[model samples]
Target: MIKKLIILAIIVVIAVFIRNSPYSEYLTFSYLEENSDALLAYVSDNRYISIISYVFVYIVVAGLNLPGAAVMSLSGGFLFGAGFGTAFAVTGATLGACIGFLVSRYLLGDVLNTKYEKQLAKFNKELAVNGYLYMLTLRLIPIFPFFVINIVAGLTKLRLFTFFWTSFIGMLPGGFVYVYAGSRLSNIESPKDIFSPGMISAFILFGLLMLVPVVYKKVKGRV
Candidate 1:
C-alpha cells in the first residue's frame, strides 16, 4: 500500500512537471489558434510524425489529467479531418483512461477499498455484475467529468478489459461529436463553441435510449 502510494505520487509529479514545462505552451488553445496555418502546413509536411505525436500527447494528457484534450481532439480533426481524428482521439483517450483507471485502482482500490473490503463486498459485487453498463451510461452522457468516471470506476473491482472496452464504445458518440466539430475548425473559435444545447439534448436522449435494454431486463426480472 505504501509502495503503491509512492509510485502514484511519482507518476503525478512527473506528469505535473511535464505539463508545467515548455511543452505546456503548445498545448494551449490560444497558441494553437495563433499558429493554425503553420501547424496545418507542418502536418502536411510531416503527416506521420504529426499524427504519432498528437496521439501520444493526447494519451499522456488524459492519463495525467492535464488540460486541453478536448481542444487537442478538435485540433486533430482540424489537421487530419474527422475520420482520422476520431480514430486517433478515441484510441488515445481509451488508452489514457485505462491508465487513470489503473492508477485509481492501485492507489484507492488496493489500499482504501481493501480496508473496507467486507463492508463494500455487496456493492462491489453489484459493480462487478453491472459495472460495464453503468460505465457505458456515464460515458455516453457528458454531464459528468470524464476523469472522475475513470478514477471512480477504478476504485471498484471492475475488470480492466471491461473498463477499457466499455469506455471506448461509450465515449464514441461524444468523442466523434468533438472530432467532427474539429473538422470545421476554421469556423470555430473555441472548444466550448462545439457543443450546442441541441447537441447536448441529443446526447442525453441517445444515452437514455441505450439504457432501455438494461431497464427492460431489470423490469422483466422483477415481473
Candidate 2:
C-alpha cells in the first residue's frame, strides 16, 4: 500500500507539473502551426534526435493521459511525413498505453475488484472469451477515449501481451489517418477538421468489422 501510494504520488506530481508548465502551450494546434517552419528545420537538421525526442514525448503524453496526443500526431506528420509518422506515433501510443495499463492495474485493480467483485467478474469473463476482438474494436473506434480504455482494461484480467498487441494493431489505422492529415497541416484550421462525418463513419465501419467473427460464432452456436 505504501509503495502504491508513493507511485501514485509521483504520477500526480508529474501530471501537475505538466499541467502547470509553460511548455504545455507548445501542445496546441496554433503553436504547431505557428512554428512549423522552425520545427521542420530542427527535425531536418537532427533526424535521430528529433525522432527519439518525439517518441519520448509521445509516450509521456499518452502514458500520462495528457491532452496533446492529437496535436503530437499532427506534429509527427508535419515533421516526419505519413509513413514514418504513423510508425512512430503508433509505437509510442502502444507503449504509453501499456504504461497507463500497468499503473492502473498496480494502483486500483485489487481495490476495484474487491469493491465491484460481481461486475468485474462478469466483465472479466467476457474479456477472457473475446478480449482481443473487444479491445481491437474499441481501439479502431474513435468514439471511445483512448485513456479510458487503457485504465479500464487494467481493472480486468486481460493479459499485458494481449493488450499491447491489440492496441498496437487497432491504433494503426487511426494513427495513419491522423498522421496523413497532419502531413497536410497547413490546410487544417482545427483538429476537429480532421474527423469529418465520413471519416468517423469509416472508423466505425472498421470497428464493426472486427466483431464479424464474434457475431459469426454466436450465430453458428445458435443454429
Q: RMSD, model 2, all Cα superposed?
A: 1.7
Task: State each model's CA lDDT, in order.
Answer: 0.83, 0.88
lDDT of 2 by residue, 1-223 (tens): 9899898999989988997899899989999999999999999999999999999999999999888899989888999999999999999999999999999899978787688789777767767766688788788875669998898889887899999999999999899878988998888899878876776787778768887977886688789
Which residue pairs show collisions in model 2? Answer: none
TM-score of 1: 0.87
TM-score per model over all chains = 0.87, 0.93
Instruction: Tell me each candidate's RMSD, in Å, in order.
Output: 2.4, 1.7
* Candidate 2 residue 76 C-alpha distance from true site, Å: 1.0
Best by TM-score: 2
